[model samples]
Target: MQDAKSTRITFLLFPGITQLDFTAPAQALSRMPGAELAGAAASLDPIATDSGFSILPTHDFASCPPADILCIPGGHGVADALGDDATIDFITQQAAGAQWVTSVCTGAFLLGRAGLLDGKRATTHWGYTHLLPLVGAEPTKARVVEDGKIVTCGGVTSGLDFALTLVARLKGDTVAQAIQLAIEYNPAPPFTSGHPDRAPAEVTLGLRTHVYDAAAARMAAALGATT
Candidate 1:
């Protein structure tokens, strides 16, 4: 049975989405005392994720209910999604009524494309934070940045942090803490190079040379074409 005071949390599903970006937060938020989760896509068809698997969406854009919290998750597909009018429109419409508008990873770009991030302080994957300015957003450095009702987080794992933060805000710290304990959301990475700042210079440079430099250029081109 649905809780009478349940908060409707909706996630936008698309091809090439970073599964971790969506799943991490969904895992935490779904355990919230009064949370209801929905994954919406262009259709009810299964949407392919970056992880080489497909997820079936709960609703189509036209059928999805207005969300109390609307979240967009990012991946390589985001560069292409930036150009999809229907996706942007769906985000715009859902955000118009959502109590909280948010995104994980490059999903912030989708919010930016929808004009929701205009003049707002936001953050995304470190590799693409520089491009936030193209969307009229002031780039911020943090795991999660909150600009009033709009919240954005960096990269994939940050979604878990963002979700717990939101749960604390909407429910209570105790409830959020309980959820965290239940999930055993602990982190002990072997490497201290999660962020560019801490990562070895050579490692960062090599990653940029092979991946981010070209990826960011494509993102820039996409944002340029849209804006």
Candidate 2:
């Protein structure tokens, strides 16, 4: 039996999630001491990822306990989730009492749809930041932005940084440092063209044309339903 004082961490699992967004944070949080972890979905069936991967939920929505931290990860399927009342309701209820509400990538969009990010400083994938206003959130360009108990991370790989920061917040600096060392989380990229501002004109144009255009269209529809 778990102690009542143990921190309950819940990650929303849905079809078409960007697996790394959830996995990176979940893995980091699992390393925290006395944190009870669960992946909750509408059902116990396996959840599919945008990358053609699958993960099983530990608990269904009805069986999920209140969460200290509620994480919603983003992916191509967020459009569908935005329109899902059950998923939105679950998030709204859980976030009401959660010590921290969070999301990675476009997962922030779901949080926004739940009406949790209104007036909060939040972020999502770089391509989707422009849509933040649709959900009443102030778009932030940082990799991670935390406004009170609401923490949102930008893009996919940023989840690792966000999780490590959360560990330091929940546990302590030492524990977080140890986990970082254990995971060898250092990065040394050969290219410096990750963000739109820093990327070459052609690369940014390509992304805006192929990626941002589609994402914006989906977000526009999602926001319409939520509003």
Candidate 3:
């Protein structure tokens, strides 16, 4: 049976969001009874993802319902949004009253840019965790870090785990477990390259790209930081 009170989950949409970060969590939360899902953007238009897909925004900034939970998903567009006032303001406003404010990957950077993660223990994509201090957040290395009302998960696939955690928080362990079982949420990777610590040095170095450095520069420029 659905709960008497529905939980409103709003995901912030941008031009180049990583679709999995939003979709994974959206799917998990939607499975919870009485959970309402929405995708909000600056305008009511289709938004593109880094993975060559597009998703339509269901609500615009001014028209979005107050969020019970506000989620931000990360992608290459994150650097651009770090300097976007409309995006930052929307997050600030919605998060103020949200029961839980959460993010996946560098989505935490958006929360940090909105000044919500200041002094909060948070996590982001492994490639960008070092940048948390750039926005006043205490960087954490956990896959999912929950500090009060804020819950941040690391990297792309972590959104799945993060959403399950959110369900457990809002509902109960039993409900969360039931949902987990329904989805068959089990991860068994064939290799050990999930994290920097586990991956071989050569494997990690080979995969490293300049994209993060460029993004970091953009973030610094947007925040008026000298570095």
Candidate 4:
């Protein structure tokens, strides 16, 4: 069992990472008892979110200290981040040593690329989920899937739900539920435009092309002929 007095939680930050993917859950984790939150980036500098939010990093991958928990939040930059040798080296090292490692959305792509998700069941943003098999992962459609110590969450906003779920698993449902309630998470969608099936096919197609085309091109460049 980990000593409750001090447990570190490291979050890996790359350029263009999704804002909410790291922030919402990061806030929750930071508040947990005996929790210490640290953001790892390319360097101890500011990294811009996908939405252009700026975050100052705590440490770089090279100098990062070990922790009990680790997280990776993904976005358009995932293609670049995943293919970086330094980032992958840090993740492979830290994840191998940590008690638990998790990712939100396209962050799973990083894990998959690093070979961490190989032989593990995982999930990612549905758009790029098709590529998981290429990296030897057992992909699932579930919003969140846990296989051993590694946990993964599906697309974008699902990071919030995924992090909450993982919090329940780690800190107990009572604690997680308390946080959820405190956050007023009883969301009621005003429109029925949530799921792929519900949205008009045209809208979905447009969105797919608009959002994913660049990411797809980047992925092709990073992955090349290798999986």
Candidate 5:
């Protein structure tokens, strides 16, 4: 009893994926009318997340159905996943027939590796935005950037914003609004510093020195080797 109007949304799941990048969007998009969500990986084995937990895929690359929306979520694993030919091939194949191809955080790098971001304006986590050009993308600063059928967003929690935005596009504002209300999507962070642009200089510098400096370098090296 499958609905003819069902919108199939497939997410690429990989080891060390940022769980929030996958789950936040899944929460919003799955609530859209007639929306079906599927997580696909290379195999059915449990995929580990950066959060010290694992997620089981609904389908493997060989058995997954073509999707209306194909999303790639990023994490520490993306650097390693970049070197996996099968993973890149899967993304290439899935994006070919998807009505909308998208990514969150460093997942944009995966899309870029698949030759999807060539000459396109894209974005990723701020630390890695500068590396987008290595993959033939013009890095645009925004939580979400839509260049044609390709949509890319910034790091982690931005997935929630990206999902609601896409839901509004696929269904309608009212439906998206209702879903937002249902999920209580309102955001009021205790801190004023979310992005580097808004964060205190010392705070941003500390984070970059501690985490993103090394992470971005690894990502850059990965992209450089691939390109």
Candidate 6:
């Protein structure tokens, strides 16, 4: 058996993945010096991100090695990806043996939908946080919540915070703090907050409506898939 320390890390990608949720954490994971990082998905082709970035999946699920750490990034495709048997089955199989399962933004929806978040505290992008419980999470508002083997983040941008938290946990606080210091990342926004509380009600409502529309559209398309 591979020692927990020796296990490799792989990030899972699905169509319509949120760019920051996938990239920021992948970057942070790579900061661990010798640790290996891979983007694994249903296909090794380029996957589309919600913010319009394109990421090439380096490993296809069929041939990818098991993960010690796994990341799931959410996007507009959650409804469809959640219903995808191949996508969800692969996640289920990989997550079963992985040391930790993590997600950013609405990606938690896919993880929650996969039965991974049942009775586990998890979160998604604030735009659709309520949906986490609709799927299965206890719905956390924290930028990052490490709930045993399950970790989740609140938004696309928070993915950076999630990665920072994960690194501190996985590699130790000094390493994590150094990274934070190196990045000059002591943040204090004039807005005084980071969630709906920080933003105006109108802004929050508009964002929520948009996310819901996307999720609903995907759900309509996923009606009969086996995921």
Q: Candidate 5: minimum summed lDDT over ten consecutive residues — where?
A: 1-10
Local distance difference test scores for all models: 0.95, 0.90, 0.89, 0.81, 0.94, 0.76
- For model 2, residues 10-98, the per-residue Cα lDDT tens digits are 99999999999989888887877788899999999999997887999999999999999999998888998888999999999999999
Clashing pairs in 4: none
Candidate 6 lDDT by residue in tens digits, 10-99: 888888777877887777667664568888888878888777678898899999888888888877777668777898888888899998
User: Which prediction has the highest lDDT against the true structure?
Assistant: 1
Model 3 TM-score, 2 decimals: 0.94
RMSD to the hidden true structure, all candidates: 1.5, 2.2, 1.8, 2.4, 1.7, 3.5
Residue range with the least summed lDDT across 10 consecutive positions in model 2: 1-10
Model 1 Cα lDDT, one tens digit per residue, 91-159: 999999999999999999999999999999999999999999999999999999999999999999999
Ten-residue segment with the worst summed lDDT in candidate 4? 218-227
Better of 2 and 4 by lDDT: 2
Please say which candidate is ahead in TM-score: 3 or 4. 3
**Candidate 4 backbone clash number:** 0
Residue clash pairs of candidate 3 = none
Which of 3 and 4 is the better model by lDDT?
3
* lDDT by residue for model 4 (53-97), tens: 689998888778997988989888888776688888888889988
The regions of model 6 sitting more than 4 angstroms off are 1-7, 188-193, 209-227
Candidate 4 Cα deviation (angstroms), residue 59: 1.3
Whole-model lDDT for model 1 versus the true structure? 0.95
The digit string of per-residue lDDT tens for model 3 on 1-227 reads 36888889999999989999999999889999899999999998889898887899999999999999999999878878877889999999999999999999989988988888889999998888878898789998899999999999999999999998988877888889989888888888999899989999877666665466666566567566422
